[model samples]
Target: MRAVIATEPGGPEVLTVTEIADPEIGPGEVLLDVAAAGLNRADLLQRQGFYPPPPGASDVIGMECSGTVAAVGPDVTGWSVGDQACALLAGGGYAERVAVPAGQLMPVPDGVDLVTAAAIPEVAATVWSNVFMVAGLQPQETLLVHGGAGGIGSFAIQLAHQLGSRVVTTAGSADKLAACTALGADVAINYRDQDFVEVVAEQTDGGVDVILDNMGAKYLDRNIDALRTQGRLVIIGMQGGTKAELDINKLLRKRGAVIATNLRGRPVEEKSAICASVVQHVWPLVAEGLVQPIVGRSFPLAEAGAAHAYMESGDHSGKILLTV
Candidate 1:
């Protein structure tokens, strides 16, 4: 099997596609002949030596993939050889073959193609678990998302909008904001030249009820400012550096809460539950075309390095994929 391996952590140039032994599965797992894999910002972090896979996980960079089952291990149920599926993985999605826990697999949605299904799992699981399950966003509430044109953001926007929340999102450019609006974002703020805090305040009575934030410390203070009383703030990424001062008084006055989370390092049981929630709650929306896969571009598996470069360029509007 050919896999993208990092020769050394530094830049996209470090990634090399080379033949590697096919993975073997244990009980409760299934081996997939990967059709396509999704590229995430975390992959770029791993390539730059900023993030490493959890203990015992494959060193390969990818976190989600769409593929067909080649074999099922002992104790696995409901999946059989030749079944088409997409899976959320801890690692090893950058390879031609990967072993995924049965609980992590989801049947391809009704209208998605094999390669496009690769774009669904991670974004679906992330947005559903964080924005819906964790934050408890309600139909009549308002939600704000950072980086709305990115994979997770695009999905969050669509899902939140369809679920009946008024959605506000931030992107870097006019065109990106327009794209976000087309995807159901009620209000799009250009982060480069606008203050999202003010925008949210003006759009909603006080502020949004929930905020799905990825900027971490940089937005912590303002995120608090942007939230309504009793609001929930879920932070899933730290692209904007770590560590900042928190105003306990502000949080106390609002009676709000902040939750910081990461999907990659979770225990298998938790991941399995999230995957199940995604399938049950989110898949139906996808099947109905109320929410859709947002694939920005795809590269052949061997050209993963170029994919990484493209992602780093920050020009893409949605998920980037590497087709096997």
Candidate 2:
């Protein structure tokens, strides 16, 4: 199999294409002939040696992929050869083939191409788990999504809108904000020029019922202040700093729930459950054209280094993908 290997950690240049042996399948696993791989922010960190694959996982860096089932492993059932699916991997997605636990495989929805479907798993799971499951965004309430033009935020806006919630999003530029608006955000504010807190307060009557934050510590204080009474805040990334002082008084006064989570390190069964839930609850939305996976761009699998650089450039709105 041809794969992108990160033998040494450094810059994007460290990612190089090479021919490698195919992965061995284990019990309950399925072998996939890779079609497209989703490029994520964590891929950049992994390539730079800041984030290593989980212990005993493949050293390769990629989290999600879409493809055709080539073979089934011992004890795996219900899935047949030639199934069209995508899987979330602990490692090894930047390759021509991957062995994924059958439970981790999700069928691509009707009307979505295999390449565009590659963009679905990770960000969809992340946004649904963070904004809906964790934060419990309710209808008739206000939900704030940060980095609204990005993959997760774009999905967040659409999902919130579908649930009858008013979606507010913050981005860095006018074009990005427009993307969010097109995704069904009720209010889109440019973080580069406006204070999102002020914008939220003005637009939502007071504050939002939920906040999906990526800035972490940098937005913590303001996030608390921007929440409505009994609101919820879910943080999935720390694009800014990691540590920030919290105001317990504000939290208590608002009866807010602040939670932080990451999906990658979760146990297999848990991830499997989330994947199942997605295949059930969200795939229909995709098929119905209510929620579309936004694919920003694609690069050859061998050019993964360049792909990571492009993602880090923050010049694109939506998911960056790699064609295998």
Candidate 3:
């Protein structure tokens, strides 16, 4: 088997593909021959020596992938050799073969290609779990998403819109903003030039009902300002830095809530439940063409380094993939 690993904690240049032993499946796990793996911002953080995989997870740097089952371990059922599925993984998705907990495997939605299925797991799970499950976004509510041109943001925009929420998002450029609008964001702010807090306030009449934020401390104060009374702010990434001051009085005045979460570090039971909810609720929208997987680009597995470099460039939209 072949896998990608960072030669050292550094830049994208440190990433390389090399021969490695295939992962052996444990009880209740299935072995997959990967078809493709999704690239995520966390992958970049890992390459730079910032984010390490959870304890006992594979050191290989990838979070989600689509693949065919090659074998099933003891205690695993409902999957068999040659079954096609996509999996949300803690790590090892960058490799040609990976061991996946059976509970984390999901069937590819109808009308989606196997490789494109690679693009769906992580983003779908993240958006659904954060926006709807955690924050309890409802129909007729307004939801704001930061980094709207990126994988998680793009999916959040479409899903919220399709589910009857008014969606507002922020992107860095006009084209990216346009893409967000096309994906059903009611308002797309150019973060480089506009004050998102103001736009969100104007768009929703007061402030948004929920905000799915990826930028951490840099947007913290403004995010609070952009929330309506009783609003929820869900922070899943620290791309904007990790430390900031919070205005407790402001939050208390509005009765708002702030939460920070990590999908990668969650327990298997929680991940499995999220995956089950996604399949039951989100998969139908995909099957009906109400929501689509937006794959911006793909590189062969051997070009994992190039894929990481491209993600860092901030030149692409939606999900980037490594095809095996």
lDDT of 1 by residue, 20-68 (tens): 8999899999999999999998999999998999998999889999999
* Error in Å for residue 216 of model 2: 1.2
Poorest lDDT segment (10 consecutive residues) of candidate 2: 128-137
* Regions of candidate 1 where Cα sits further than 4 Å from its true position: none
Write the residue-wise lDDT of candidate 3 on 1-324 in tens digits.
Answer: 999889999987888889998998889999999999999999999989899999989999999999999999999989989999999999999999999999899999999999999999999999999999999999999999999999999999999999999999999999999999999998999999999988876778789999999989999999999999999999999989999999999999999999999899999999999999999999999999999999999999989888988998999999999999
Task: For each of the candidates, give the backbone clash count.
Answer: 0, 0, 0
Scanning candidate 3 in windows of ten residues, the lowest lDDT window is 197-206
| Cα lDDT tens digits for candidate 2, 46-160 | 8888888877677778899999999999998889999899898888899999988888899999999998889999988887777777777778998998999998888889988
Clashing pairs in 2: none
Off by over 4 Å in 3: none
Clashing pairs in 1: none
Displacement of the residue 173 alpha carbon in candidate 3, Å: 1.1
**How do all models score by TM-score?**
0.99, 0.98, 0.99
Q: Note the Cα lDDT for every prediction shown.
A: 0.95, 0.89, 0.94
TM-score of decoy 2: 0.98
